[model samples]
Target chain A: MTNTNRRVLLKSRPQGEPTPANFDIVDAPLPEPKDGEYLSRTIWLSLDPYMRGRMAEAKGYAANVNLGDAMVGGTVGQVIKSRNPKFKEGDYVVEYAGWQSHAVSNGAMSMKLDPNAAPLSAALSVLGMPGMTAWWGLMKIGKPKAGETVVVSAASGAVGSVVGQLAKAHGCRAVGIAGGKDKCDYVVKELGFDACVDYRAAGGNLFKEIRAAAPNGIDVYFENVGGAVQAAVVPQLNDFARVPLCGLIAHYNEMQPSPGPDWRLLLVKRATVTGFIVSDHFTDMEGFWKEVPALVKSGKLKYREDIVKGIDNAPEAFIGLLKGRNFGKLLVQVSDDPTRS
Target chain B: MTNTNRRVLLKSRPQGEPTPANFDIVDAPLPEPKDGEYLSRTIWLSLDPYMRGRMAEAKGYAANVNLGDAMVGGTVGQVIKSRNPKFKEGDYVVEYAGWQSHAVSNGAMSMKLDPNAAPLSAALSVLGMPGMTAWWGLMKIGKPKAGETVVVSAASGAVGSVVGQLAKAHGCRAVGIAGGKDKCDYVVKELGFDACVDYRAAGGNLFKEIRAAAPNGIDVYFENVGGAVQAAVVPQLNDFARVPLCGLIAHYNEMQPSPGPDWRLLLVKRATVTGFIVSDHFTDMEGFWKEVPALVKSGKLKYREDIVKGIDNAPEAFIGLLKGRNFGKLLVQVSDDPTRS
Candidate 1:
């Protein structure tokens, strides 16, 4: 059979913000399944802010996506053909298939997904990396005690939304900081955050707003944005407060080191700030599977996805994700499902 | 009896670097000991970096030295007279007597010094607050494991000297970062550090020096100087490394907010930086007194003191301390010992 597949590759590294010139869409031959490998057609692709770090040449938790390579990503796919005994033709699976319409995997790095267990797209979102990030960061780093205030930036987005909900479930006073009024309202009204600060509004004095909302002081600052917002929230942190440094989306596009008053004050206050990548904690997957699913099942955890139809729109959707245009977990639906479509 | 005593009080708040105008030396009446009290004559007065924080009006862990109050300090003094059963005439003790030649205190905060047990000045240096700062910061925050590489900045200073020794005793590779070759040599030869980086000679290439010294990456950073030195040491920290931030002498004199490319990148490396005042762990003093003195007796730990003579010289000594002019634990020899005199 003739092989025909489309893929998005990193054509060049962007100096600052990624533009269309940074990526190239091209048609390619889909590979045949080798021994112990399975051929899969991409059903859904995840577009995350961390992808920006992967595109940069700087040393990060992971290696940079090399030029002329398909941009790396988390994808949920349908097994079209299989040489591996664990996966069969017509099975659904999740894998790191990049921005490709199809891929061949050895099944070692792939997990079987039962569409009947949950929605297929959930494999790329709430049941996936973003969900695990929120679980570990809130539970391990944030450590929100009962009635303690947990302030999360990017409040209505993927990890932050889940973090706020999980914190609420732990009997914490959840406060959200989001850019727009709409996102702020959603976080407070639907996600049950006690207060929501609209960072985009006029007279947006973050220090004032945070102090007003959390008079007792912030116990856990779930840091996602790391420029001026960090400067404001840091002073309001109580002694022994914990900060889970999940992502610095604000400085991801910076070509030069961002200017700042040093964070030595964080040390003075006896506060703790830690960074983590979810992949490093794969050893804790058993514990995660045991806890997160129950939280989701009981509605103690919730998630949302902004789905764009077709693989052709993946690059644009990813760029928008970094710019905070997407309300929640950003996903590109790459194919029609016989079950849903 | 004639009441003639020299006292130094805070005349005004400093705007940038403290000046002689900010302090007033005056003649005051010798305070009489009340019931359950003792009148103490200052002998050796401690001038520490924490005192700088106390001089400021800013809200910190400890109360600021109020304007018009005698500048607060730790002192090794002699109880010239006592009204309490716990003390006797001519008893040597340690007290919080500020920069004054004479003062009265209730037995509440005085620790009787066993003049034969250790040097009287040891009560203010290696055996007292500075030593405790190192003890708690290392055992509690730095948590150095055997075979780990521990890096301490300000290596010849009071706290740094103790930290380097303790790390060496714990079987960690103790590397120090000090301002000059002399200080670096003192850290390596006298203080028992495995290696020492001369931060001054490092110029703008401190990161390179740190990388060269700690090829395996640093597991504990005893952070005392927090500016360019901190920026250099951070990138060399291993994942899950601990930083005990005891001081920020580099920025202590600044009136305005410090300019910076924020060191939040340090947090993103999965390292923990924690600031603490030694007093917060007063509960741990029993444990420290049990451990540190034994280490000192066995020749496993070492310390140094820079003693300036006379109460009149304290302001200069303190100012010099801020500029890194005074080496090791800075102290003022307030008066000639009447017994020796």
Candidate 2:
């Protein structure tokens, strides 16, 4: 194992689409575990859309990542040293270890993961925050009822894939909007989505394509990507439609905030729209754990991961995530997972 | 009484803002009521902002008024002839009587009004649709808790007036936004809103003024008039703010649908926005009746009227209403109210 800690730091804030120059990969002395803290080596570093919001100077739900600081993210790691009685060396855990190879946790907001229960890397994807987000936004806000049509944007991505599956599990018709033929095929054939629209190839007929897919019109829209996708999905909403505004990845890269869809439709349709963040709902984690992990373990719910080899590649991988390049849950493999082969 | 029924018909659909030329007041031959129906002489005709939407070809929650067809409206009238057992001659009732002196009702959706309980005109405003709309949207969707700041638009107007008063009754800090000094003063001084911002005089500092008034940030925003007012109010939303989108009168006359507020704010604040029409929620009317009328009768809930006399002036009065010319609930008195004098 390397004696040095390699951290990806936010070098500059992006004006629009993020580039590699916005981040700096640096080698620093290994961090020490202080009293009531345990040090862990990051095995899998999460690359999520919300991190883009934190890099910007503009205020969002959470505080921005200060300039020259290590970029913040969730990670699955194995403890190397411990001062906290609750955690010990060699135990695998999940915490906000950020975009770094090593991190110290006081066990305040960390959870232990049993590798035998699920894949260690799954702690960063299907069995973790993304899964819980899908469960909460889809069930709590979207409130998909049986026989209703549920359309999800970014269907092949981590949260979207889970949302479509959950919608299907609830006996609702699940339609997906994806970027390309491969992802569209995966969403339909592999993920069991009722239909998947290839938005990139749909040209100017996106609205028509979505309408054709959802013959009864969309009732619960899991809005993962905003902009054109949202504009198309909105007009096709059924009366009393519920939209859980989970992410707006398409507009995150725009320098100027773009104009949104005509809200008159909301009034006309008598729709309910709720914008949610998973962190605010962590208190409901027990409810999520009661269902999702079991579904994932039984092969009832499926997930995919696009893993980059190193922490140095996290910046490029994350930028691609914004552009919908990563096929599934985008994660950087920071170190060898002792639990895995 | 006149031998002919005077009716206002849709003459032409307005391209943008409505004009007097869009309507034609004409006299039609009086017709006899058929079996299971009653004929009534229209007394008070409600002129509301939503009427602007029905004049155009664009479809809304309710059907459009066809060209050359009498404008559809709610009215409080007295039955002159009855063939239906549910109604008796000289019974004062409220129904969708349209913009005409006489209407034939099957009594499928008509309610008898007791003038002795309150003023007959209150059936068309404070104790009726507008009042019930305020109650449902505020209580059901806005969900304002005690100590929260609730801001209402179109203050001193029928629906907005009730909304502010209701917010205050719930122990919330109620602020209002209206067009001029008179309406603002009336909202604060008479209607009991904590503060009222005159958007006309606020100039470019509407957001600044609203933020100043809502020092703790707006928790519940009763959105009546959209466009600039919505744009200004949205940015000041506190975390988990609830917005009940009751109307968009500001955009009602625009030929093309205008772009809406920056929806990113919704995600950032984790806000919940609901767009509702009162017609869809008539089933909840029982709860509304249980609370609102008693408040109005007890002098705790206040209402005002801007009455334009005679059916001949209905067209001009309605045109003025869309431009915020009416200071209160805009109504056209088609005939002398026996209950009033």
Candidate 3:
């Protein structure tokens, strides 16, 4: 088996918005697995906005990616050689393998991905963290009722797409906030959202636009993006509105506290705002897996993937993700998938 | 009856912090009680931070106080004249009687007050809105486990004192944040709080002081103040912390949004923040009155009221209340309590 592995290391922390210089791409030899460990070749590397938080030295839910260490991420990989009884050679698995082509694991965080049920790449995207995030925030926290207006930011992206679709499934008016005309169009047309507000569009106030879109006022807000988008939606919230704060992607690159409206907005609406980490609520993932895939298989729940080729390009893809450049679930196809053709 | 009602009217909206000029002292003729109606003389007027929100023309939980209208507030009063069967003459009741010395009501939002049980003044304080506010936030939202650390801002004030005492009763460590050393002393020494930090002290960071007070990290936060105090508390919050946002007195006077940390602090901690209006949760007040008085009777709960004399002093007292000049629950004794004297 080839021992050579290519890795992308976090060279330096970003001051504000991350640039390519902050990442160092290098080739290295993979170490052999001892006793209870196994070697896995990366098939899919996830490029998420969460990685931006991991890059900051500032305190967050996850530890920051230290200088000269592999930038931490979720990945789908296939075992090339095994020293553990639980995993065998050619078996596909999903794990936190970071930004590396090869990883040696004792299988503490790794979970077996069924190759027959779905594509191995789906493990790092749809059928994995992002899917659970959308499900957990929408069904668990947002708790949208039938005929209620639910709004999601970054609505064409990974988690937001699922949130809007799930809102529709639950008999809600799903209004999405997306970056451009294309994403906004895709969010409404392809993602089956009731309406999509183009945040990039100029002229009238965005707050007024959101109010017009959700005329009865938002009841369930799936907060994946913060800043002007959050400011706009907060005032338009109905009494007893629910905000499931899944992400703050818009403020991840912010140098200082964003100048925004006070908690008075939340207080005035008597809203419930909850911030949750997907890992903390994984007990419900089984229910999500059982439900979402069936919806996906029947074409009732559709998904889009933005697959950028190779591990070296992961840094640029991740940076673009923070800038709202990626249209859907962003992934770095690091190597050829053994589970697929 | 004299038929003259002394009132404090909201003459003009304050530019920033409310001043004496924003209020107008006026004498108006009291309307005669007609069929199915009654007239009540205000014995005790309750001054709360929530009134600040009502003063703002912006959308909030309740309607804004229109210019030249009597400022709204809760008041405990004796029914002087009654034309209704439910409320007889000379019976005590609590109602939203605004800032007027006398009011006529149809008994819609009025509740009979027990004059024999506690002081009629207690109907507007410990045994009333503020006490219930503390209980609802601490139990419904905070949900503190035994031995968990709970932090509350405005610790010596009406709601905070109750919250701290309640936390202790529930077997939780209560750390308080107050504006001065005297209030801090009252919170810690008198209220049985584990510790209290003086937010106005020099040199040391408020966050550091809070961290020191709550060594294990804050599990539940009762947010009454929301400026530097909130900023300090947010970072010290432990994972899965609950925040019952009852008020933002610190931001109430602000012309714009206070520059503070984003909700990322909450998201990273996986915190639950609920903003509530006590009026919406009055169904549980029956339960509060039943249980809380028992605790108070057994010396498990202690309350102190900072009572100001005269209906004329209400405007200045309310202005001082915003400045944190009052030591405890701030209330204006409008007239001689028929039950007390």
Q: How well is each residue in A30-123 modelled by candidate 2, as lDDT tens digits?
A: 9889999999999999999999999999888998999999999999999999999989889999999999999888889999988898999898
Error of 2 at A148 (Å): 1.0
- Alpha-carbon RMSD, each predicted model: 2.3, 1.2, 2.2
Against the native complex, each candidate's DockQ, computed on alpha carbons, is 0.56, 0.85, 0.65
Name the docking class for model 1.
Answer: medium
Question: Model 3 misses residue A306 by how many Å?
Answer: 1.1
**How good is the docking of model 1, as DockQ?**
0.56
Deviation of model 2 at B104, angstroms? 1.3
The residue pairs in collision within model 3 are none
Cα TM-score per model: 0.95, 0.98, 0.95
- Weakest 10 consecutive residues of candidate 1 chain A by summed lDDT: A259-268
Question: Candidate 1 residues A234-298, lDDT tens each?
Answer: 88889888888888888889987766445556655878777777888877878578887787777
In TM-score terms, which candidate is top?
A: 2
True-vs-predicted CA distance for residue A131, candidate 2, Å = 0.7
Ranking by DockQ: 2, 3, 1
Q: For this target, which candidate reaches the highest lDDT against the unseen true structure?
A: 2
What residue pairs are clashing in model 2? none
Worst 10 residues of 2 chain B by lDDT: B254-263
Clashes of each: 2, 0, 0
